[model samples]
Target chain A: MSAMTHEEVRELLAAHVMELLLPEERASVVAHLAGCAECAREVESLRATSAELALAAPDRSFDARRCNGVRSRLLARTAADRDARARLAAGQLPEREPLSLRPPHATAPESAGGWRTASMVLAASVAGLILFGGSILVQSRRELAQARESESQRQRLIAGLIGPGVRLIELAPTERRPGSARMFWNQTLGAWTFLAYDLAIPAEGRTYQIWLITPDDRRISAGIFTPSADGNAIATTTYALAADSLTAVAVTEEPAGGVDAPSGDIVLLGAAR
Target chain B: MIADVRSPDDADALVTRVAGGDEHALGVLYDRWSPLVFSVCVHILGDDDEAEEAVEETFWQAWRQAERYDVTRGAVATWLTTIARSRALDRLRASRRRQEETMSHLSETKRAAVDATTRRGDDPARSAEVAERRVLVRQALLALPLEQREVLELAYFRGLSQTEIAEHTGQPLGTVKTRVRLAMEKLRDRLGILRERDA
Candidate 1:
């Protein structure tokens, strides 16, 4: 390609940083940057400015539960990849039981070779058996640990509800809705236990989201939950903020996964006392 | 584990660990940056499901390409946001293609209704430094002339080429290019502190 003039290259730098240049123009800009110091510096600075545009987008409140699910899946996939690489490096095939360890009801292939093959198959079976037993023990231990963690979480929640420094905030239904709720905010523990009753079931593909309004009127997502068929729901979450900074609490009906901001009508409202 | 306080150095260290196959470091990075990434995706895609999918793809790409990250190019947050915007735009373009083929009859009003479903709210839970930076960036964007800001928004968020933006806005191609250049330079000037800090 013929060399573009300095003026032409500089004009395209902004568009290039925004990824808005046509393919040919982008190629020309890339080529020019390789040979032009000034254009390269300008492009880098413009690119950094372009990136800051992302901050202009409003924050969307993601469902914490859903976020956790995504993180878990990501970690699992990475772990699986790591294990496969390790196994490959160690000269082992992917995880699978030896044929000799198949259930007794399954048919076994006839011995196709002599004592060497037989000895290897025997050794494989023994190794598979040991691995299977080890996995079972590990699984049991993991389950026990999980159970203990769950119990401990429950204990913490109970303590937060009944412990000293817990303040009760009574939520009254707005004129447009029919529900009453209460919040047990333990500022010292940074725990919140919310319980609502007589709330109408949200429309299909909708759920109730709780928001903590700061004194400055900034709304922060506490959590999202759906009421039971009998018009009752409970949710617990932890947030760390100065007690005096919170001014009010409100609930709104939002899309199934909830929204980053309150766009729906307020269903219940309460002032932090 | 997610730390209560994070600096640019900490973020760089996290990326290095991620490059070395540290899953915990990856998790901390995800926790620290996913909200901003998700927000960008939602702004571009305007659909939660697609945006969520884009977030997953962005971080997964980050995980696979961690070793290629260049701190000299920009900060970690900026790098992640760049990846996020690219992923979201890819999804947006693909979905538009599908819509053109299967839902050609869909009216512009109906399409707009879908976009309207995305709501906006501040995440006060974010670090004070991030929130302050957000305020500063927003102020700079708002201070731009309407025409200049319009061109930048169309190109950045809507992923429109200069020629396409000219067509969309019924302006001349040269005018569109000029507007983009002016807007970016002004933004660079207004957000100079960010540039210095990233340096």
Candidate 2:
């Protein structure tokens, strides 16, 4: 397409907003839109107007079953998407035909092996978790499996601490427990390794909860884990709180799956300063 | 379970969680907007199966591209609708090409007679605000001049480019562009006024 003046391109602004411009025409209009504030506002206004079309449909009847079907399909697709990304990141999938990582404007269907590959990756990840003592970084919704996977993940975090810029925060031994704990954090990677020394293992139904105190006094659950038969437990988790925003780190005994807040006896309190 | 009502803040929060790879948040977002997304698809594809596929593709794309979603561009619903519209058009355009190739054997009227029924019989607006907004939106579209509305629908719902719309309507390309621009200008003014009133 030949170069068009600003006025000429403005005529196509509506169509451009609707994404009706062919690629070259789109490129021209996009170029014009960049330097022309007036044209850009027009485009935004047109876009807002177009978005309202979503409301223009007739009252659609509610179908719980249909909604559920779509929900399940979306959930499965999302899971598959995450698995594919994880596999690609892990170099487990074929590099030549990586999962489609197209930009938002361009998307393609997953290859036939996409879901099968995802399942394989997930199984492998879970197997790896088991071999590492059942702690793994997984996005699965199964709480029991997640709890088990978290344990092995904790071990990995502890192992990763010695590699780089790791900061160790000491947890003074509490009166009720004679055990001492140390929290090792890799500030750059935002990984935490909690080592509880001589901490007593809770009964089968209970676990130790690690908490991160934000400057705003908000306590976020880091993870939940039980000590081994030897009364020593290590937990590792990815926490993104910066050193300044993190007020302190603490561990408390709580029921499995952790809680919204620290609701149990504090076994160890570590000053993050 | 996804709640029956979700505020705008809820939509933003769900998207944030989705960006963090939270499948449950994605599910909640899907449940919240599936009707609107499906409606856009059905209106464009005019076929249940293709529309269903578009819905799946839209959410799947949303999952993959959640991080790219810019709130400054529009809300979560707007972002999802835009994606749905694009996907539906892709399907519609492919079917259109296939029909054109078979045009030697099939009539245009027959081709246009493909199943246009939506998957559901009733409006799926679970909240009063959504239902009211739908009524206002329909009114706004209806308020547009017939000529403008015709080109707007062709460009938007039918996924026709300006040139294609010109060809379809037997109008000059300039005329088609003018109609689309006029339509958007009117809708923009009208919706702006409505928003101010609501505010």
Candidate 3:
């Protein structure tokens, strides 16, 4: 880019302070500010002006007195994030408790009736075990092996959620189901996790599938899922694509094995907030 | 962890610890700053739930970008409030777009209300209420010429670029830039005078 004139640079100073400048313009301003003491002082003055302007906004002194759960959520998320990053640095996947350890109601729909939901949950678990366990060496070790794999995948996702530079985008339910999904993604790593909560169980032959719609409108599968009896499913995967390339994520009802495209109802949808 | 963060330096130290993965430091930072952050978000987005989301995301963004923070630019509160404002504006854009898209599905009166809300850049009744609550910012902004105030609001609250503001207002790019510069300069002058007078 051509060097900006003093007059042109002056125009950009305030916008630069507000971070409204385009990337190239920002770089040019930063470059100019380095050598120009006069411009730097101007930047500082504008920054102070911005600061005062910001602090002058309405103050919720009374609201701050109440200890809402904001800090706890921040700490839980921060611990999760820091653990994920430490595990990555250590060259070991983060440790995660198996989803099976969670109570059935925590992972499945309570509205489905107690005993019926329990049976359905057990049946779903067995089917998943058989499908994934069939590849194992011994049939006797199927459950153990499946549990171990689930634990490992769970750890990987936990790490991804609190991973370095992660953005946790909460997907709202578009339908009547009382469930939601929160996605955590690190743009640099392209690692993402979709944490689906309290979703309704799919029919016997149907499953919940996630798809990411790219900015260019290409639908990429984020993989499929089945909530345990407690109605929770955690799916973690790497996209190897820039985070900005994604426009939104949606969960659709699909066949048991999943499909290449969305052909069912979108139960939940959210943009990159 | 130290429980009392009584100064900007303490806040700076907290940020350093947060960058090092100290969750306690983050909590302290949030305790110290969330109300201001919440207020900024609420003023811009005008929805409690959305404003709360902005607060959460702003702190998380602070954590993620902690290592990149430069103390020389401004104090931690300033830096954080900047992030909060940016995130709130992002929500405002999303909310406005959603309203526009879903207007046809709403009642005629609701559509008209939504249009008025959008055109005014915020809910006027809420703005008036908030302006009463925040005298300093309101006074500072009210002191500006309408042209300058409009450009400044578009740039700061709406997150519009100079070119976009120019296009939105049907003015030349040069005019928009000049108005913005003049506005900031005027604000700086007026705010400085107010500060010295208060002192």
The local distance difference test score of each candidate is 0.67, 0.64, 0.63
Clashes per candidate, residues 3 or more apart or on different chains: 1, 11, 11
Best by lDDT: 1
lDDT of 1 by residue, B1-199 (tens): 0121123688899999999989789888888888888888887887877787788788878887899998777767778888999999999888877875233322332333233223236763255656666666677777787778777777887677898778766899999999999989898888783356446
Give lDDT: candidate 3, residue A83: 53
Off by over 4 Å in 2: A62-65, A87-91, A94-273, B1-7, B101-122, B193-199
Report lDDT (Cα) of residue A230, candidate 2. Answer: 47
lDDT of 2 by residue, A1-273 (tens): 788898889888878888878899899998888899888877777777787666564444425644554554455445545655676688554322112211122223223222100100112223222213223333333542345544334234433354335687889756765777778776544556676667777877787788777666767767776665545555565555556767787888888766766789888898877
Please state the error at residue A215 of candidate 1 in Å: 46
Q: Write the per-residue lDDT of candidate 2 for residues B146-182, one digit (tens) a residue.
A: 6777777767777777897787768999899889888
**After superposition on all CA atoms, what RMSD does each candidate show versus the true structure?**
20.7, 16.8, 15.3
Stronger candidate by lDDT (1 vs 3):
1
User: Candidate 2 docking category?
Assistant: acceptable
Indicate the residue-level lDDT of A212 in model 3: 73
What's the residue-level lDDT of B60 in candidate 2?
82
DockQ for every prediction shown:
0.33, 0.27, 0.26
CAPRI band of model 1? acceptable
How many Å off is the CA of A46 in candidate 2? 1.1
